[model samples]
Structure formats: C-alpha cells, structure tokens
Target: MTALSELNDDIVRSMSVGAVFSDFGGKVNSLDFHRTADLLVTSSDDDSVRFYDTTSAKLVKTTYHKKHGADRICFTHHPSSVVCSSKHNLDNSGEFLRYLSMYDNRCLRYFKGHKERVVSLSMSPVNDSFMSGSLDHSVRIWDLRVNACQGILHLRGRPTVAYDQQGLVFAVAMEGGAIKLFDSRSYDKGPFDTFLVGGDTAEVCDIKFSNDGRSMLLTTTNNNVYLLDAYNGEKKGGFSMDSSQNATIEATFTPDGQYVCSGSGDGNIHVWNINNEPTKVACLDSYIGVPTCLKWAPRRVMFAAASSVLTFWIPNDAKPGLESGGLNSEV
Candidate 1:
C-alpha cells in the first residue's frame, strides 16, 4: 500500500484490484463507502442494497426492497440501518419517493411524506436526522429517532444536498444554480445564507463541503465546478469542463480536501486538485456507462466509483513512482 507521506499533490496511482465485490446484472444507481468501517453499500435498479467487506472484497450481505427499484442508497450515521429511495415498479411516469425504507433482515419500514421522487439523500452529522431532496423542488428533514418528518424546505429548483463533516451545517445545490446553507438546529427557520452562481439557465447538480468545513464545492450541468468560501459564500476558484459534451453529474472531495473527483455522463471520472492551482489528477477510462457517483474511503485506503457497476480502487502499491501530469504542486 502507498503510504500517505509518499503521495505527491497531483498524482494518484491506481491500485490493483484487491478484490472484486459484485457482478450485478443491472446498472448501479448509487453507492456509499463507510467513513469509519471496512463496509461499503451499493444501490441498484435491481432493487437491492448489497454490502461488501473492503478488506476481503467479499459480499457480506444483500438486502432487497419490495418496491420497484432503488435510485439511491446510503447508510445512516448511526450505522444500524440504511436509507434508500425507490420508484414505482410498473410505471416510471410518476417518480415519487414518498417512503424512506430501512432494511433489517430483509424487512423494511417506509418513512413517507414527499410528493415527488427523491433524487438525493443525506444524514445529518450531529444527530440522527436525515434529509431528502426531490424532483418536487423541496427538501425534507426526517428524524429517524421518531420515524417522522421534522421540517420541509422549498427550493426554486430541484436540489441536491450534503452535510458538512461536522453535521452542524448542510448545503443544497438548486437546479437553478444557487446554493443555500442551513443549520440543522433551525429546521423550521429559513436558510442562514444563499450563494448565487449561475442565473436560471445553469443547473447545480451537486454540492459538497470540504473536510475542514472551510470550503464548498459546486458542480453544475453546464460543466462548471466552483469552489467557494464556506463561511462567506465568496467564489474561491473554478474550472470548466466545457470541452466535453457530457454533463457533470456529481463532485466529491478527497478526505484530505486536496483533490476533487467528478463523475460525468460521458463515462469518465476526473480527479482535480483544489489547492488553488487546480490540476486533473487522474482519469479512469474503464467505465463505459455514465459515472454517476464517487465517494472517498479514507481509512480503508480505497475510493468507490459507481457507473453501471460499483468499482473500488486502492493505491497501486506495486507501481509507486508512476506519475500523472494532472496533479498540481499545491495539492
């Protein structure tokens, strides 16, 4: 394995396949690698959430939902149950995630409320509350402790949500290209701040906060990624992927906040350095399907990339010195 000290700012050596986890017949919709454990969870259109043991690359368990299929899946902060989104099985016309299902021994409990399909979901860092963003142009905070919806916040456009590392604050990237920040403690109140980026034409697809909570990253359908000052909502720096015809779906920060990984509809995963002098660190060329999600697993020394399949990459330990030109010195 590559030691943390040996890694330079701009290059990421692709690790060998430590183990292959699953060979799902259908496409993988979304996935999440656990922050503190060796486990990883994946959701697919096949209507299941499969768990894998990263250390052995073995399938530990497979939990199936009775609904049509899952659009997204994530583990709760408490580590006991999983939160998943699904659409109607027969007709895909009405996409509404009225229920947030928790899987335990193949049994499920639905947390229902929203009138539209849930597009994105996240759990609070400070409490057991979880939030879901939907095609209905609204976000609802759910308290798993009581299995009830706590508060609902409306947006001008469809929004994607993520919690900061501390869980005290959360960010929502609206489809109209604005980001709203809110405190988890004040759910019924309005947002504490709003950062406007593009006008009505640009759609914000994803938003993430840095590990230190000092910076925020925003990705738009226009192929632009912006880094903003977390506290002041000032633009720090941004890069455009205008050369490609594909839409950038999601962007995420590496654990150290040195690199940002973006998944695109053109079936490519691009990694970028965020230390002022931005550089494209690595591009994984194997995914033929659109790369929909990316997650960093810091402790396991692995990162999860989801396209049609869920793939895990570790640091290429055998070939340590290989260099990729995309890493910036400041990374």
Candidate 2:
C-alpha cells in the first residue's frame, strides 16, 4: 500500500481496491477504527464481530453473539474491548447494549435503558463515556465503568450523536436538518447552540466530526451527505449520493481532515474533497455486494468497506510485492 509518506490531495483520488475479505454471511452494519491501536472492528447482522490488523489487513479474530445479534459497534479506550448494540430478537434474551471483552469472550456489562432499537452508538474520545441514540426518541449517555446511563436527553425524531475529537463537545442531529451542540461537561443543561439547515425533511442517519473538529458530516435517509462548518453549522457542500437502495450511508474524514469517503449502494466507494465547494474526487468500483458500511483507517493510507464482503483499499502506487494477508487477492 502507499507508505506513510506525506498525504497530498491526489493520493485519495489515486486509490484502488487492494484486498477482499468475504467471510461474513450477512450484511455488515457498522465499523470503527481504534484511535491509537491500529485495529479495525466490525459488527454485522450475521451475529458476528470481527477484528482486523490494520498493518497487514488480516483477520485477527472473529467472535459471534448468536443470541444478541450484534449491530452498531464502537471501540472503547481499551483496545481489547468494545461496546456493541444488539439487533435484539423478539424474545428479549439478548443484551440490548453491552460492553464486551473480545479478548476472552466475556460480557462485561449490559446497558438496558433504551426501550426501542438503538440506531446510533458512539464512544467518547477521551473517556469511558459513550452515547446511544434509539428509535425510542432519546439520546442516552453512559460510562463504561457503570452499568446504568449517566444522562439522558429526550427529543423528537431519530437522533444521531457523536463526540468531537476532543470529547469536550458533542453534536446531536435530528429530524428536519436541525443540529444541536452541547458541552460534554454540562449536557444536562441542554444545547448551547443549534443550527437549522431546513429543507430536507429526512431523518438523520449518521453524524461525525472531522479529526480536527472543524467540520461535520451529516447523512440522511434520502441518501444525502452534507459537510458543515463545526463552529456555526454553515453548510460547506456535500453529496446527493447515487444510491439505489435506502441503506444508511456513512462518510468518513481522512486523518488530515482534507477528504471524505463513503460507499454507495451501487457498489462503489466515493471520495469527496472539502473546499468552498465539495467535489467528488474518485469513484472506485467494487464487485462485492452493496458496501453500505465504511471507515477510513485511523493513521494509514487505506480504508475498508463492507456489505456481505469486506474490502480493504490502498493507493495504486505501492511496492510491487505488497499484498493484504486476509483474503490475499487484490482487486
């Protein structure tokens, strides 16, 4: 893959698919990259959680939760552990929200406060605190050290929540293109700022802050991704994705915060450059199923996308002998 050289704007536009891991039998729901551990984790509808080594792009471990059926997954500060939201079968035998230790297959704790399916789950960057947004119309914050929720906020429509890179601030995106910012320290006092990009009435599917915390990405049910100014919620530019399905699309920011990448229902990975006007830089095609779930590597020149199969990507100008270890076939 592209060595860790100075990443310029053209590197992302020159990327190509490097590896394919088609081990999962069902669709992947979400994925997270560890901040400092160089690991990538995924939870899928197939009732499985898989971990991969970012250096080699090899499968490091795979575990299953047949009873709970894992959905959205995020890594806590501890590299060996993760917080997973369950798909939750009708019988209610599964843990809705759980702290799982992937090392020895242990369920450390169960968070049972949400009454409906949780749609968004995010871990704070600087602490054990995590947030979950559910169909029950609430955003609940919890600490890994405690089994109960530490704080809660009730709101209208589906909520998507995320913590800024510093974990000192958080943003909540809701119906009707409204974004509310709250101080992590005094969230109980409610939002200190709110922005209304009113026009699209679709429910928000996802929200993320850039690594530098200067911009935010908002994705909605109608397959639109908007880039916004983090300071005052001004719209920069975004993509009206050419997606054939209604799957939730996620856009991830490169470590340098200069580029954004997302997968489309058409089985292609789209890259966009953020400027006074965002532009689509590249569209790398994949033969695999719809790659709805995606993420950029924390500190590498690569990104991963998944549907029924998982694909790892890198720049086209890598060393000749370089090969991904897991599903070693390069696309």
Candidate 3:
C-alpha cells in the first residue's frame, strides 16, 4: 500500500493539474472520497452520479438519477453505497435522502423528513449514522440501518453540518457565524458548546474538522475562509478573495493538516500554507471555471475540484519524488 499521505510544502508547491474530466452535462454540485478507498464520486446538475478511481484519475462508472435529480451527495460507511439529496421529486417524497447501492443500481433505502431542500449532508466516520441540514430550518439525524429519522433540531436560518474525525461529536454552523457542538450519542440534549466566529457575519457555507480533530475550517458565501481552534473557537487566521454571488466556496485541509485549499470565483485554486508562521496563500489558475467544489483526498496526497469538469491535482514530480506520489497515471 502507499505510504500514509506524503503532503508537504515542496509537494504542494510543485503541484499542477494532473487530469481533467469534462463528463458532466451540467455543473458538478458535490463530490466525496471513500474513507479507505482510492475512489472519488461526484453528483451533477445533469442528473447523474460519476465515480472515479483516484489511483488512475480514471472514470469508473456513471449512474443517472433522472427521477429525483441528485445534488449534495456523500458516501456512507459502506463502500458500494452512498446517500444523496435530491431537488426533484416524482411524487410526494418531500426532499428525501436516498441511500443507493452503486453496483446493483438499487435504492437500498430512502430517508424522508425534510420539508425544504437539504443544503448539507454528512456521513458519519465511524458508523451508519448520518445527518442532514435543510433550508426548512431544521437538522435531522438518521441511520442507514433504520428507515426513520432518529432526531431533529429546529433552528433559524440556513445550516450546514459535519462530523469530526472521531465521530464522537458533530458541529452545526448557522447563519450568524454561530457554531454549536453536540455529542453524537446524545445530540437530543442540545449543543454542549457554542462559539462565535469573531468577524464573519455572512452565513456559514460549510463546516469541517481537521483529520486530527484539533482545528476547524469554515467558509462563507462572502468569499471568506477561516481556520479556528476546534476546542476553544479561538480564531487562528483566515483570508478572502474575489467574490462570487450565491456561491459557497469550500475550504479543505490536507490529510497531514499542514495546509488548506479552496476554489474561488476568479477561477483559481487558492492554497494557504498555514504551517508557516506568516500564513502564506498562493493562487493557481483552474481550467474548470468557477471551481466552487473542491476536496483533498482523505488518504492520498492528491486533490480534486469540479464545476462541469472534474480536475485532479498532483505533484509535478520533475523536481523530485514524483512517482512516489501514487497518482502518477494522470500526469
């Protein structure tokens, strides 16, 4: 097996676009990587889902969701299944999250509850339990093993949700830069801790915890990304760039937690070298315009971004240690 994530300053700076897949007829809305697999998957406005083998930067399969229309998607704890939110409905299904089996093309289960669109969906890191935040002003928790929602929270404004590395707790980001933390086992009890992101007044776009559970990253529609202490909510630092209307630019952390990267309205990939004392941010041009959705591979030194096209980033090995990066086939 490949060595556990070789991400570093040299590898990140030497990185360039490795491969591009323009397979979507519409914009790629969401993408995710399997927890322990080299596989990456995306959901698109074209009403389809596509999976890629990150090892080769190659397409593995494509499935259509014409009836419901796929949007925010996430891989469940199982390898061959995923939970997807949909914008279109054939009957009175409401805005339901569909649990699908990729290999057999079967709807393993349908989780129903949200009255409005589900804006954020996250699969648990350790089990079948998952959670969703909806525009209807509520957050619901569900388990793949059960057909019904296990818990729900009614809150004001749009919300986004994420599970920490250990899955022992989860965080919810609200409209006023307020973040609430809850224990997964007893989430009905309410958030044990709440922290305000000092200056960002824009609605929270997405929230994520670093692999070490030490830091948190939050983004806003106003084109700002902030890194904070996951435990104390102390602001570490953040940066902003050109604005994109109504777009949530996601910021992701490398597996080693040394850096964070995000896409911007100006069609550039912004990399923040946070490990440095001064926190330097670099910009690299992107072929996929408005590359709003981006993610770093959970277990590899590679990263992927998308719009209507999906582009993979890998180290430009001519300087040194290129082949050892593991995603060389695309280069």
Candidate 4:
C-alpha cells in the first residue's frame, strides 16, 4: 500500500477511498453528484437508477425503467429532476429520451430523434439545456422547458459531447481523431476550431472538460488519455492508460483540477498529479469490478467510482484505522 507521504514526497495527500456500495446487482453505467447535497446517483444495467446518501452510505431512492431501462444519466439544476437516455432491449422499436421526476418516478417529457442508441449525455452547467451523442452519427441538443429538440449536429462517426463549466461552449469528439469546439448559442455555424489527436485510427470513447473549463480530457478505446487546451485545442501533454487491462477507460480531473483519475479493467483506480510533472500518485484497488463510471464531488475532495460495486473516496486522513477496509490492496 502506497501512502500519500510515500508517493508524492511531502505533498500531504488528502484523498482515499471511503465506502463500498454494491447493492445495484449489475454493472454501473454512470455516476453523478448533486451540486448542493451530499447525494449521489447511479444508473445501472439492472434497469434502475439509484440515489444514495454520500454521508450515510444509505440508499435514498430507486427508480426503475423496467423494459428499456436507463443509461447515460445527468442531473439538472432542479433537485428532483434528471435526464437519462433510454437503454432499450433487443426487440424495442424506438429509443426514448426522458426527463424524469425522482420524487415519484414520473416521466415529465420525452424527446425522440436519434436513429440508434444514445451513448453519451451531458447537462449544461448553467442552464436547463443538455446534449446527447448517439451511434446514429448525430448530436442532439435539447432544453428541458421544451419537449422537442432545439438543435442537431450531424457528424461522420460516433460522437461524445461535453459542456464547459460556464455552459458557454461545448466540445464534440467523433470516431476520427478530430475534436470540434462549438459556441453554445450558435452551434449550427459549425465548429470554429478543430484538433486532430493521435492519427485517424484513434477512436475516442469519452470526453470531459475540467471544472475550471481550461483543459479537456479525451479517453480513447486504444488505452490512451489526452489533455488538450480547451480554448485553442492545443495538445497539452497526456498520460497513458497502458497499465490497465481494460481497453475502454474513463479518465477525469478532480474538482480542484490538480489531479487526474482513471479506472482500470484490473479493478484498480489510478490518480495522477497533472500539475508540474504529470505522474501517477496513487493506485487504489477498492474491490470493484472493472470500474466504468467515475465522478468527483463538486465542492469536496471526495469522489465516487462505480462498476459492479460503488466506492466513495475521501482523504486518507478522514478515516485513520479504516485503511484495512481493503483500500490498501494493490491492483
């Protein structure tokens, strides 16, 4: 087990894995945190979306999608509302885009247009609008206030979209190595800037903007992660996901934007310092099964990673004797 003192010299590491939640009974597809509450939400292959109390490690709420299920979910500014793309079964006809009320599990609105499954979804930082990327080769932008799609961008390959912190701009990465930046208000003008990463062979699986909105994280199916300047698309260095056996990994920046963390197919969670010389600081094997979804709290030093099980992470100083809770196990 590597402690904060051993890995970064004298940097005083303030982070560690805290709790393990595995009641979902299936693979967790996504994980998200509430901006103002100590609550977290997860969507899973069990055909359910679950709410958990971060502090108590208790189940707060559960909503079932049954046949079609839910995936790629994001919470809106509203406390009781969330938008999630439907996960359809083999015989289903059309996919549904839903605005669901967590209070009663009621469907508020449905926006339908994608020709295939929606693989990615992201809510705006400052508004009720959201975006979805699909295998159908298109990106759809919608407003919660309206039931219809407000705008759409047609691309050549699979797309993953994310919004900047201010909701002023968004980035779209397709099957090719190209990443396009668009103005939130006028996206139809097409991307004002584009960055080509790797070569034409690198297939990007996910993309996220830092909380500070200055740098972007791009994860590829080829076991690579790239960090790029958000404004100019300059290739600012990156770290490789080579250690992990998982071909598809999701990497994200901590809330403070000082570090980067990613999940491994070997069931280990790796954190790296992005400042100064970028290097791996810690690796935590929290007994998870191929952690696919990872999220950091908006206002705290804590983060949650999900797979077949869900793990809440906090500073090691927060829990002294609990290190034996299996956090010390190497991946």
Q: What CA RMSD would candidate 1 show?
A: 6.0
Give the TM-score of each candidate: 0.84, 0.94, 0.93, 0.89
Q: What shift in Å separates residue 48 of candidate 2 from its native position after superposition?
A: 0.4
The model with the greatest TM-score is: 2
Residue-wise C-alpha lDDT for candidate 4, range 175-232, written one tens digit per residue: 6789999999899898889988855357677888887888899988766788888888
**Which one wins by lDDT: 2 or 4?**
2
> Roughly what TM-score does model 3 have, to 2 decimal places?
0.93
Listed per model in order, the count of residue pairs whose N, CA or C atoms clash below 3 Å is 4, 0, 0, 1
lDDT of each: 0.68, 0.83, 0.83, 0.77
lDDT of 2 by residue, 76-127 (tens): 9999899999886723653579999999999999998888888999899988
Least accurate 10 contiguous residues by lDDT in model 4: 3-12
- Ten contiguous residues minimizing lDDT sum, candidate 3: 318-327
For lDDT, candidate 1 versus 4, the one ahead is 4
Off by over 4 Å in 4: 1-14, 89-93, 243-247, 320-331
Positional deviation of 1 in candidate 4, in angstroms? Answer: 23
In angstroms, the error of model 2 at 193 is 0.6
Query: Candidate 2, 268: how far from true, in Å?
Result: 2.0
